[model samples]
Target: MARNISLNFRVVEGRDLPAKDVSGNSDPYCIVKVDHEVVARTATVWRNLNPFWGEEFTLHLPLDFHHLAFYVLDEDTIGHDDIIGKISLSKETIAAASPRGIDSWLNLSHVDPDEEVQGEIHLDVKLWTEAQGPRLRCHIIEARDLAPRDLSGTSDPFARIFWGSQSLDTVTIKKTRFPHWDEVLELHGEEGPLRVEVWDWDMVGKNDFLGMVEFPPDVLLQCPPSGWFRLLPFASAEEDAGGKLGALRLKVRLAEERILPSVYYQPLIDLLVESVLSPAQDDTVTPLAMLDEVSSGESRQDIATQLVKIFLGRGLAVPLLDYLNLREVSRTNEETKADRSGLAVVGRTHLRQDLDLGVLGYKSSSHVTQGFSKLAWCEQSVGAGPGQVRTSIPVCRICAVERVDENAFQQPHMMQVITKNRDGQLDTMYIQCKNVNELNQWLSAIRKASVCNEGMLPSCHPGAFRGNRWTCCLQQDRTVQGCSRTHSAVTLGDWSDPLDPDTEAQMVYQQLLLGRDKLRKKYIEFSEEKIKLEQEVMKGQSCLEEERSGVPEQERPPTATAAAHLLAVLEDLEQAHKTFEQQEKEQVARGSLHS
Candidate 1:
């Protein structure tokens, strides 16, 4: 029995807004929806405060989607798509229900959060960083120690383990975010006694997973998943942070779930065959004595061949091409034409090694004329003319016997084509060929011609997954014309930093508009209040002067430049009030983004 490797994705959003960093308490962690049901939500542990408790919800996803939107009042906020700040997706596949481990799958780059850094200044203070190092490093600088972060993510170098876990035989590095990092766990034995190694953690070939672990017999028996982990190995004092106070307790969580994300799989057996058989070979024969055996969960063809291989004879045989290597060209059960050019099939696919194609195709050399066990064909021939050459006959599969009713869909007996210009004398000549590549290339050119030269709804052809990035085109009747391709702009990964000149400019422009609007409202309210206050002050001055001078009291100075100076002072106060109002509004908006 083979081990099954797997992945499961977990997402955490800052729901309560107290929702702290992913490693700590208060994280709004939620389990992925399985079969359209929200069975469980992840546990939130705080980094600053180490309180662990279950985060309950009266409102769930979709059900409380509106509530979530309300909290997300500012879409322009920072960390909108964070590992914890937002809800992304996960992709994981477990072949066996019994909990067996998997050997390997594709797309395993285990560094998303590792590619970036996360930080905050304060609820009211100022601090900024553009965490950009390699995949697995972090950067931290003591506050008030430098200028704000510049364009680059380089500054104080730092290190962080996104996730960590402890296991039986060996610990592992893991993540639960989907469409996120891809990681692997490998186990190789030592000295045939007790040497076990599980490497390939990052898929960067860093051997992030490569290590020697001495474990019990059962521990190294199988491979592990990405979620497995352990604490950092005890380092000597020299390697420590060397803190005067001591190491701070930074909250952490070892993810227990995994996600499949967007996985592209072909057939496993196909890969195995590719590894074993040489493309240069003609006969389906394998030599064992020349084969070096390694335990990579690899298998071969015949018992005789296996015996030869194990016994040091030239007999390493695996018939990968005979089975999984074969491809069905059309719905008619027509096998692909043998490529004398011998091009290797590219892309991801899967192969069921347990099934035999000889049984499925019902192919037999003895009945080559009547292939497919109970199948027959029809034929027709044509005559020759001045510019034409004739063939004896055309052959087609007419009927098939066994499982013909079982598998109903079949390709047409033959593909049809119509040629507009047979002379091939045009500058732009379109020719149809039996080759899939040629056909695809021809379609590609036509598409380019259509999008570039002529304007069409949605631009390129309706069903193409990708367009001619180099050129676009159009066609009228049979002739075609084209132009260069164009693309839309793409922004940077993070929008939090004000270092972006455009972003800064936009902010300033918006702030100015907001300030102007607010001051307009305040100006009216302040004017009436100021006038009334001045009247009272003037009356007091009048009474005081009248009582003192015996000459008309108004004639006394009433203080120098009385009304004008008073009004000017009042205006200054009003301006100050407006400034405070604008700052408060901006602060409220900014707090929501990071808080």
Candidate 2:
């Protein structure tokens, strides 16, 4: 089974933050992390004890994640950023919240050094009944991809194995993330679970704890445990202060999933494939039609994901998706003509809108822009004035279009369109939207319209130019280089990544193999009969091939032609695999040389 979580959250604001700068204020920014991986970062709010960000993000993560952390840091241009504090929400705590999700101010807490460990260790263990007593043997083979502890980006790692009160240590490997220690330690009649802890050796003070793994004595006795185990920090109580350090206003929501075995999904996969290969009539019953009738919205999404993977494994995803999308489009056309027509109009308008020259009119622009003008259109040159009929700015003169942080516009949702005016000076217009969705749509549409414009901006400020400094980077000059890279105008693509049929099929096959025992129980009665039939078929094929061996090559049966074609396909597959192996070796060699 596989578990998934859909997370939606906003870093609204921070209050009562401790000052990290000498001027009595800090340039604060928020970094959101899901289980050690940084997912998003908010623009820095310069020189503010209390700052409002109002940035939102949506992330899909594995449900097995340990926690979500929001780290507030003071940005500095000259040195590394200072850590203000963090808010850690564990999986259990988030799940216990209301289904509508958490919407409140969360107090920040100090980070503990012991909670920062990461990486994994590989171990092999076995138990034997000796003349004296039952002896346990531990093989500390190696550890790879260990987290760096030193400033030089490497750690001197060593492992200590404990069985009851007795412990053994391995020789430390210096200045490398990948460490190998092919040493075995023997323990006589250990009474408790075996614990293996990997630590980083320090020349001064005590060694730092990297990560640890444990195996029960019962498990070791039953069957020797041998594999790479993910390292985890020692469990400790989280320390959270009640609004002393600071508090952050946040809203978060999660979605979860549980996947079943592949053997159980085979029937559904077969039906879906059959529907695509031999499409049924519109009125006929099909697997997709039945699923639509029965499954909930969330279930449908999960099922669709699985179906896509299954078809991709079979190298039929494109046709299957086209078949399903065509059916859905027809259904929509039959059900609501008005809504379909409206969507068609919107799409056509977007497609016709030229990048170099186009007109965009919105009613809500009157309050957002400088004047009472409600229309923005391209002109031969910038010509807008106080008495102008409409706000005309040349699309070719547009420099940048970027999201406006809440601190800049003092509004919940806004974006800035920077262009050159009639005076040949940079002019900015802020556009407000009712909601985040509308803001994204308008931003995407405007970006699409002005993508091909010449002299486009390479970077843009995400924060306001206020108080004689850029809010994000604290640059004194108004036209100083942007602190953040500007995003490309191209929209995100569909989720069909490059196909790897072998990998996809292997994943499906592995899932089925994991439940092989259950499959055996279900099909045990037919096993002998199936094997007998297979043997008889193989015998008959061999006899027929022998009889056909004397036939002339030109007079050979169609089976011979089919066999030759299959052989050619096998040869091509072998060649492809060899080419891939060679490429992988070259890449590894290059990486080693670079290191």
> What TM-score would each prediction reach against the true structure?
0.15, 0.47
Model 2 residue 260 distance off true place after TM-score fit, in angstroms: 10
After the best TM-score superposition of candidate 2, give how far the Cα of residue 287 lies from its true spot, in angstroms.
19
List, residue by residue over 1-595, the lDDT tens digit for candidate 2.
3333557788999999999999999999998776664556788999999999999876545445778899999999996799988998987878888467889998999877667776567789988887887788999987755666776556788999898888999998776555668889888865789899999999998988888888887788887889877788887787777777799999987655333334434543555566678766651245344333333433344344444545644656456656655555666554544433332232222323311122223332422212212236332221233332335555567778877655453454667788876687787766565554555545654564466667778877766677896544445789876645465422211112112223233333333334333332222222323354346447775322222232343543333322222223333434544565677689899999986
Give the runs in model 2 whose Cα sits over 4 Å from its true position: 1-4, 257-595
CA error at residue 220 for candidate 2, angstroms: 3.0
- Best by the TM-score measure: 2
Residue 505 in candidate 1, Cα distance off native in Å: 56
- The best candidate by lDDT is 2
Least well predicted 10-residue stretch by lDDT in candidate 1: 399-408
Instruction: Give the TM-score comparing model 2 with the true structure, all chains together.
Output: 0.47
